[model samples]
Target: MSSRERVLAAVAGIAAVAAAVAAPGAAATGRHQDWDETAYRGQIEVVRSDDGPSDPTVLNGTVFVDRDRDSRHDRNERGVAGVEVSNGREVVTTDRRGRYRLPVYDNMTVFVTQPAGYQVPVDEFNVAQFHYNHLPAGSPELRYGGISPTGPIPDAVNFPLVESSLTDDRRLSCIIAGDLQTYNLTEVEYARKGAIADLARRNDYQGCGSLFVGDVVGDDLSLYDEVKGLSAQTNGPARFLPGNHDLDFDATTAVHSFDTFRAQLAPAYFSYDVGEAHIIALNTVRYPCTPDLDNVDGLRPGCNDPVNRPRYNGHIDETQMEWLRRDLAKVDRDKLIVIAGHIGLLNWADEGSAIHQVDQVREVYELLHGRKAVALAGHSHSIENMRTGDAMQGWRDLFGIDSLPFPHITVGAIAGDWFSGRVTEDGYPTAIQRDGGRPGVLTLDLADSSFQERFTVTGENDRVQTQLGLNTPTYREWYVARSAWNSNPVGAAPELGDPLVVDQADLAGGTWLTTNFFIGGTGSTVTVRLNNHRPRQAVRTQPMRGEDQFVGPEWSDPAAVAEQLVHGGSVANRTMHLWRFELPTDLAPGTHQAHVTATDVHGRRFADTLTFQVVAQR
Candidate 1:
């Protein structure tokens, strides 16, 4: 209760303020941890501001409504009439000055969708030009993966714009292909002949352009030139991302994984817009092997420059993350965002390997929230049609069926199995599966935000080729009887080049079987039935194996197309010993039937029937 006590209190306050300033995540003037994590509508931010009334909320800057990137708002380049802008969630729009304002958060992205008939500036390789965030201490680096801390929203969020007519056309389309992992020149030729042939012919996709997800080539980087040559055959622009195999093996640092990739294939991580969609291509691989024993190739002491030689794994570094945050901020929530890369966000196989998994996968999901999106990838040479919301915990299980907030598809290989061994009649390898199924490609038809997908094999063209059949009880007995007759081994090697066929059904478990029905006529439908009924009841119903496995679109013979278009007659179905349908349950010892009917895209029908005997139930 005296002058001495008051003086001591003032001095104590000063000491407390100095201590707070010395600590991390703290500001001056002893404002404590009072941070505003709310939404804001500015593009510039200030960190380490002194607390008290002196703490300025907005940074000193100007948000000019430059309808052009020339730093001048021209008459014709006037601001769009009424487009909604946002700070991730809360929305606002520009006034006559073509500007907006809202609350600010620690880290934020403020962007605008260019109104139709107008445009925005693009960077050197044509990436859309925009501005955000001036982080002081540089962006934060990730351990396994992720971007830097956002810090705080900037002061002025200004968007630039331009004008163009192609903004609102109906017939726009984009081609998405994956894993052109060509190991040799021959395999590269196979890719060029098979996949490139289809692209050269499709004029409908000229404007939409094409994106090759990853593995531009096998580990051999020399094949890149050949791959790009093939890509140039298409009538659209080609964009690429590097897969694990596309790394520059000679480099000795963390950034070299994509230096050559970026030199040839645009920005390793970037974004572009086309027809109501925002496409984000991310560079998930972090390169440069370190002294840490956990590195894949392990300590490359011979190569030691971080900039020249990069080492990496499944990851997104600080630089790319900062760009992504700014990029996503510029995009409107309602618009569709297509995240395309070589590695999938969710996969079933090799789930634990850091080499294949994205460490910050969960954090990226949190950033996007529940906006309309789809993720596409190709590293594993398999096709997976996975819906969102599925648990992707392990690698052995197929995560294809689980529902998700967005659909994710892992497209089949361009050179199925490195064009494996010998070339087939189609000028490509017969690349039979180690797992199962022939080669194929995926086709996605997008309408605005909604889209449909179909898998088309290089030689076969049809929406559905799966044939599910039931096993008769007698057939079950035969399946079991065959096992006993196996004096040697159950899986004795069959003749080379013979189609992998199962004649004797294994009653222990029912397995899905498949038949490749390459029908090439109009008015035709391919249907499978038991006996005379279109829907014959089998003792056991099994799905067709490799039914939807397709690697490329149908490479049709123009002569065949012309002939079939007019004549419209049924061709005898070639049974290549592709699949064997199993009869379910125990059928009374007697004769049973198997049949198939084909109805082409033109609506004509063709049918075939075969019969087999049932001994007894297994």
Candidate 2:
């Protein structure tokens, strides 16, 4: 077993007692099965005012350290000083007495930034309760139960925090999961068996916790309760960021678009501190976006028009931008800023599209000018570990970004390809991503300010990182035919006959060993060696050097496409992780084994092998 595995095994004893403690309100849901006892019951204490709407301008709160596992601020309890509090726009730190006062608005979420060395109380569903939503007039008629009428301004919204050694430790394992877009209860079950179960099995992530970067459910927001049941099973506190799909479609304006998401999951955007990492989770998807605020003209020109209809755009509003500026000011310069959002700042899959990329890309780059930071995002189902200086044309045209200022990683989705494709024996779908990556969760193993990233494929260990296949002229032809058939349901699906057997014509034309190295990017390298021969450096398919997307059948990953096209899901047409090593047109026509090794920018290496047969003639 690995050293990390050993540490995780040893953690069970220390955590067993905590796991035995049942959450106070878990029975209310009647759904917390595997981790009912482990569920956290504590929640935010919203104290109402006797003055009603007379004194609704200002709000006051105390962040108290909750001992005895109760969600109340007793007279004997002490207050946690230096914790930052925000009314969404303005940020303020707690005074020496741990008391804070902020100007209030009717429709705003008042939350506390979870400071290091302490933990905010979580609900029965393991959702951290650090915020109080105050909406005086309720929501403007919505489907999925938007916030209930929060009558008047509260006298105090005391935030209850508990002392936790798990969050205080310098050794942190932060799990970044993307797009658990469960449209129905069945899809929710798939997520439970897949990534949720994977998290429950691991005990090492208690400190930094798990942050799901949006699309908690599909369009139907009613499934939030079912998804939260899955969240209760996780070993760490669950945090979520809203995505485009998580928006309230009935809402007419951008401000109220995520009302239901905020009520169900968390604040639209928030920040938390764990060890030396200052994690900023931003809500980048703006629903009912206007043409002007989209920044890039013509990109989303159909905002308020009857013809095109207003849709969600990749943007950060003025209010959020202001909050981010203030939030970064409080963070220490030495701390690693983990910037996470739904739609990424820039990505390889959507490198040319404005809708998939963020509009405030340049300003965000300026915000973290010299600070040590890494951007994490979802939206794009593909896994990308982009390094600094990696450039793409879509980013240049839409946002005028020449190269990445820091490492911007697009964490692969939990519900891979919308949970499409055939069901595997393990009770999950074979949802291969668009860039040919399998469904998985990302982990950042942090020691102080520095970190190393690792991707864990669903139902597989860390060692199983890359997928191996052979791309030949014959396979390319089949890919083209099958792709055309997928566009329109006509004729029988084309078959890729004997992908391992490359005939004389294939060897003469071209045949190459392909490695779909998930999370591999610029600075990363892949090499191939056949039967004791010297390793040949395989060329990366996409250079990520300011160019349009390199797509087609030749660039497609045959291994991933085989499952996607035949069953269901997006075709693995273009990818940044694919590396090709052309085979030599030599004489030997027999069974051959090719060894493949992928080395990331951090120098961590993963190995995979593929065996194929070479025939004399077709």
Candidate 3:
């Protein structure tokens, strides 16, 4: 069968399974029993009083050295001084007694900025318990049970820490996974075999550990346990940040929106230090979204207009900005700052959107002035490595970012394309991404303050960097035909005619070799050599500087499209890292090998080889 027919057949075969798995009743029992409809049933407008006591509420906390490794401050435990703490807005250091007092308000999360040479106590699920949520009245009535009102402010809320050698070394490796987003148990299995299994076999990241960049589950707060179980399989501590999907949609107020998440995971946003890197996890998602015509969800009459209903948007509130300013002021300017969040500060996939990109990117840039910095995000499922000086007109016009100050990467998802496509022998889904990239996790290997990033494709090694294909008229015809077939119901299966066999007519018509470098970016290079000939540079298909997106076969990676179009997933439309080179028409017909080498912006290189037959005619 042709590619389109295969995709349709696959969909038809799984239609009943999808229906049974997605049935409303299926989600109402077992792990999903706690998923209340009130949380997402209707909208409720949240109002708060601006008025407060004239006197600041002094909340005291002790950062004690847990000699016993327990998460409690025993009578014999000694306080460790000089550690920094925050009440989500103001930053203060512990006194000589390792005691800190910060003004607290209702709905404030006071957390310690984990210091190097010390480890914060982890909960049973390995979630760091360094923060104390001080919501006096707890969360308002909603589903997914938000924070229970902590009644009144306590006199003391102490955090326990133990000395550790994990973060004392100069070398650090961190695993960054994006969007586990398992809507059901089957998808969870896909994750176990995919990135989680890869992480379990590795011993590299003992200090920095793994940070899942949001979307831990698909709105079902009950699934947090299953997700946590998956994290337990990893070799190191697993940290999580909240995504738009992690929100308690029935929340009536912004303060209580992420209560369930904070309770199950870590605080909404926090910071820590390991070696020379200071990691800042920010809560960049703003919910109960104010009405915006630019909202990507396409909600009727906008988010704020229809009041009471909660909608999410990518924005950094003033309080978080204040916290960031205070947090960075205490850090050494020479240390590398790694800022991570759910939604990206800026991305190429949603180039024309303000909702996907942070609203205060310029302000964020100014805050990190004179410091070495890099950002990691994952709301867009595509893989993007945006180097400094990479400029897109949309980013410039929307966020006033003339050029990237540092690398801003969108890590590919662990649940690639939401775990779609056929299952593989490895017990995972072949969920190819919208950009035609495979599922993977990104690793930031750090030596002191400097670092380099590499993407490890799930079930594959680091060497599998580039995908090769031939961009000929036959492939282009198949592309158009397949696109039309997937969109309409009556079209026949898309046949590529013969992708492997290239004719003299194809060579005469100027067919080219295509390379899809998964982690490649601007300043990167791709070179191709055929039959031991001299190496030739392959030009990038789309230059990221101020241009509209170039899509279609001429701009796509044929190797990826070949699998994605046939397997039932997103088509590889446009990629910033794709490169192409024209093939010679004078060569004699024979089987040939093309050796491809790809070098990233940091001078790291990966190599792969592709073999194809050259024939005069079919």
Candidate 4:
């Protein structure tokens, strides 16, 4: 069957399953559940104590070449020396015999950082199996079954690797997808048709593959298998990180919270090397939230709740910091370091919200020190390409981060707006993100230590970059009316006042052209030309000069608000990357075509056109 047919089949299958299953009420804020809580409660005995293994247990492992493509390490296959291994906290290098030992504790994950010029074994779902969970007593009783109790630490936990030309090549393409937050089987089908199908047809990124930054599922950890099945459709190996929503909130301690996630996916944090970059996937989310005492109210969502209740915040523990330092120490400073995390280090969407930005932003910045680096994260559904030196008042006041030390990007989510919106012709929701970006994935093309990043809208080609529209009084008035209608069930959405026809009065009253550059940021520019007129620079709505965010119709993306407000999704109230141009009042009443060109920070340009008519009066 063709790709479209396959997607439709998957959607139909999921709909059938949804019909057979029952739905549950929404859980905590930002969490959606499909299974009844009482059904799985107390099913598995909670192992709350740390009595399974003594602290600092000796854990040994070997990295060897697999000659036959099998995982087993035979005598014929020799060991590869100098490969790195970690037990979440400590980092070590294999000796000449390819043997490495690290102090492991209960609930620790022992993983190998697949060295350059070699690759690790991948499971049936194409997920890299370079790590082993060492939770001797297993996880606390979780709604979804977590890691089973492993009675004892193994004598040797070997890692098998194969040599491939993909890793050795100087040029590489990597896919980064943020928040595939499928809340239910229906949303799962939405993902299957959207980004998953798009990834299935792509042949690129077979080397570095795809790294899902976080929020693999909404709150239903049970959907991991379905998520993995989607990964199987991709053309390359898949790796994942745990987001706040992926946690088992019932767990008493932070160590056991992500047990289910680890059992199903990869470890919360790990590193791997391919081509010229060292990809460090960091677990920046801290559960049962702990923040600086002074900023606890600002960072923790339920800081005022009962102390026992679970909350989450963005933080990188001291142990992970030490491991990061050791990991970076072994790498060449010139090599590119790609840091992936669930919560962003810094972002424009949550400029004033301390909880969304990493608490240890300065520490991470200092850890990278002299290395070339770029950070990718996805908790906020908006797409932001923050360049170095980008500044805002909140980051400076709360995190003491005066300016971005390096590039930090928030990749748009595959399940944008929590997978809410009207279904499209392709059997998926439009799911326009809050920033007005359509659901998509970001691909980073790397050569040596440098890289250029671009976003691909699901089921669309690379050229579909910017969305254009006219921002007039009529549009703004309709925006408010439509938004109110969406919020209240009583009113009908009046047609968005004519976009193609602009009255002379509206032009004289300061109507302007708007361009929503989804992935645009500092160092990016938008230029517009009207009916063969000279190209004029369009001014960005928000100036990233340590100022507060600008909101409302004047700052919103008209093209995005048009659909978002009518359908069910977040209104496009504000954005950091939208640009606007004033219309010419002297133009005669006639048909006009406006050509818009958006140039990204890396000098890559994308063009889009908008045609509208100038009328004498409405």
Give the candidate number with the greatest TM-score: 2
- Per-residue lDDT over 1-618 for candidate 3, one digit per residue giving the tens place of the 0 to 100 score: 653354344334333333343221101123111111101111111112345323348877788887765456778988889899998989999998898889878778888888988777654444556777778777777677778776666657787777767676687788889999988867877887667767655657766778899998988887777787676555455788999999988876566678999877888988999999999998888776765533544522345642555567787888899999999999999899999999999988887777788877889999997899999999889899999888888887776677799999999999989888889998998998888788989988889999998888887777788888898888888888888887884856877865777988888887889888999999999999988899999999878887767877788888878888888888887887788988898867999888899999889888888888888886
Model 1 agreement with the true structure over 121-195: per-residue lDDT tens digits: 443222233434323232233221122343444444456554443334433456677788888867766775566
Lowest-sum lDDT 10-residue window in model 3: 35-44
TM-score of 2: 0.92
lDDT for each candidate structure: 0.48, 0.84, 0.79, 0.81
Model 2 misplacement above 4 A? 1-40, 52-55, 304-308, 488-491
lDDT of 3: 0.79
What value does the lDDT take at residue 415 in candidate 4? 90
| Lowest lDDT block of 10, candidate 4 | 37-46
Runs off by more than 4 Å, candidate 1:
1-167, 289-312, 395-404, 433-437, 462-528, 534-582, 585-618
lDDT of 2 by residue, 1-618 (tens): 653343344334324533564322111122223343444468988886566534569898899888766888899888889999998899999988789999998889999999888888777567888898989899889887788898888888899887766676777888999999999868877887677767766766766779999988899998787777777667678999999889898888887889999998899999999988999999899888776666346766655452258677778988999999999999889999999999998877888777788888889989999999999999999999898998888888878888898898899999999999999997999999999999989988888998888888887777787998888899888887887888886877788887888887888888888899997889899999898899989999998888878998788888898788789889998998899988888838999999999999889899999989989886
Listed in order, each prediction's TM-score against the native is: 0.56, 0.92, 0.88, 0.90
Instruction: Give the poorly placed runs of model 3, Cα more than 4 Å off.
Output: 1-56, 292-310
Q: Global lDDT for candidate 1?
A: 0.48
- How far does residue 320 in candidate 1 sit from its true spot (Å)? 1.3
Error of 3 at 293 (Å): 12
